[model samples]
Target: MKIKKAFRRVGMFSLFVAAFLVTITSISNVSFADVRDWVDYEPMRITNTVTNTVTESKFRQSSLEKKELNYLEQKKMYISSDEIEGPKTLEEAANINQYPKSQVVATGYTAGVESTGKSPGHPEYGITYSGVQVKRDLYSTIAADLDVYPIGTILFIPDYGYGVVADKGSAITGNKIDLFFNTVEDVYAQWGKKELDVHLIELGDGTLTEKELKQLNETDSLQVFRQQITES
Candidate 1:
């Protein structure tokens, strides 16, 4: 009788564990692709499992029922857009920038052997250290020392656009950072290497989630941050 009761309890516990795991899987896999269909709407941001940026999209403002939208706008949840057209000089970058600006050695990287010491044919060739797939998207992917920059640091370069720290390079340490380029030639002829002042939009908490973004919205300049990235 005792053994039978024990078996039944164990079975129930196993079922509970399975259900929890399934629920977690579903939540982490949520994608924003469906949001592309929305028309006649306002801008909003969402979170991904890895690195996330405050991306703007057109959606029916009424969809939020005025809660999230109101909070976002009333609280001024975006960064400053004054960085658009980029700062012609470090002085200009620091002057118009809303965040704490600093200087760092910046270089361009490719997903090839010359930059990553990995062949292009490799399966993980373009994957960032933080598991983000590197792409030429609205914002650029940046590589730096994870110890120094964490995983989601956003740096706005003068005369350049915004770059998010999603990868790490073995040689990148201290205050040095690397910007991603689609091709090696672009790295050499275009970006190469230079020292520039960068504005620290927000320092990621070594984790990606909606919580971190919300925290930034509360205290940082997220309104202009969106315009700088999208418009510039």
Candidate 2:
């Protein structure tokens, strides 16, 4: 009778142990799932870096919302005005001359390259690094009004495509739109100062998203930093 009772107690203890282990495993899995969800839901930070010069074209015309009375015999009514010639220098760019309503905003940075060193191809000069050539994030510059446009702001320049303002440059100051060219030859190919009307759209704070963060790992800038790390 005592042996049978001992057997029953042993069986009960075994079942209790098994249940305890199952409960522990379930709790661990739930904890892991919570961590996984948090990681997946992480927010993205994007930052845009651009140059300090913006080009405004007076040639652009505003479209009429609605036109009344289309007279076929009258040859229609459209006001065609001459281009407003403006100054090209930074000192002259700040003046709200042509677009009277358009506000003047300062953005900094001229051109950026993969790094501070390295020469890019210039057709006339061969491979040179005298003038800046932006290989990455070329169009959008950091806005001077950090209050209005905080860091990590994304800017869209329809003329220059899309660019992120990751960092700021010293030379980029004031209302400027710096053009990025892969090579010096490309810059010269465009010829003397051309007039361009750029469309600027603000993207979010230009913070580095997880996807962009991955890109930095493989970029040349990372290699440079690695070399510095070893040297230091």
Candidate 3:
């Protein structure tokens, strides 16, 4: 009976040990499955988070760059306006002319007159000597001394706006400019002599050389002017 009892106790102890081992193995398998799931899922979550952060950062940078570019453009426009103010004296005018033709500025008196479209009775009449038609519209015409402002030269007159050197006259000499009007009444009424600022935007073809032509071709103003002419 003593031996049998000892045997039964030993058997019970072995069973308990086996049950504990099985429980440990099951726990290990569950832990490994959980690790595998984390390995499979966590990298994608991390990659998505990083991608969103980079995209947001790029968007912010682009917005800031646009604002900076706009500010620079506004600043350039302001500076250009200040630079175009007319020079006061003949010496000043000469000095400005020494610079690039595109940058020349002249301040002078302007007189307006009507075109009769006749002959020897009116020396300044009808079609321009340069072959350009005489029109009273904006920037369409102006009578200037060819020696001073050649035909095809573009001028920006304050209050009067833009005009081209399309015609010439004996009395329209030096810094004096003659603005053409369609009717004598309109000339007498609104086209009185006045001191004005003039900005020489571009020199005429007669004044530019081949080298100068190459240079003028690269200018933004000339390009824009040509484009305007083409469009018109």
Task: Output the number of the TM-score-best candidate.
Answer: 1
Descending-lDDT candidate ranking: 1, 3, 2
lDDT of 3: 0.54
Model 2 weakest lDDT span, ten residues long: 58-67
Which consecutive 10 residues in model 3 have the weakest lDDT in total? 103-112
Q: Tell me the tens digit of each residue's lDDT in model 1 across 50-167.
A: 7765566435545433323112236656756764556444335335356888889998888888877778688888888777767543356788888878888867776556567788
TM-score of each: 0.49, 0.28, 0.38
* lDDT score, candidate 3, position 64: 31
Worst lDDT 10-window in candidate 1: 64-73
Q: Which runs of model 1 end up more than 4 angstroms from their true locations?
A: 1-96, 208-232
**Candidate 2 segments whose C-alpha is farther than 4 A from its true place:** 1-152, 191-197, 213-232
Model 3 per-residue lDDT tens digits across residues 34-75: 445545543222235655642222443343334321122354
The TM-score, computed over Cα atoms with residue i paired to residue i, of candidate 3 is 0.38
Model number with the top lDDT = 1
Q: After TM-score superposition, what is the CA distance of residue 31 in candidate 3 from its true location, in Å?
A: 59
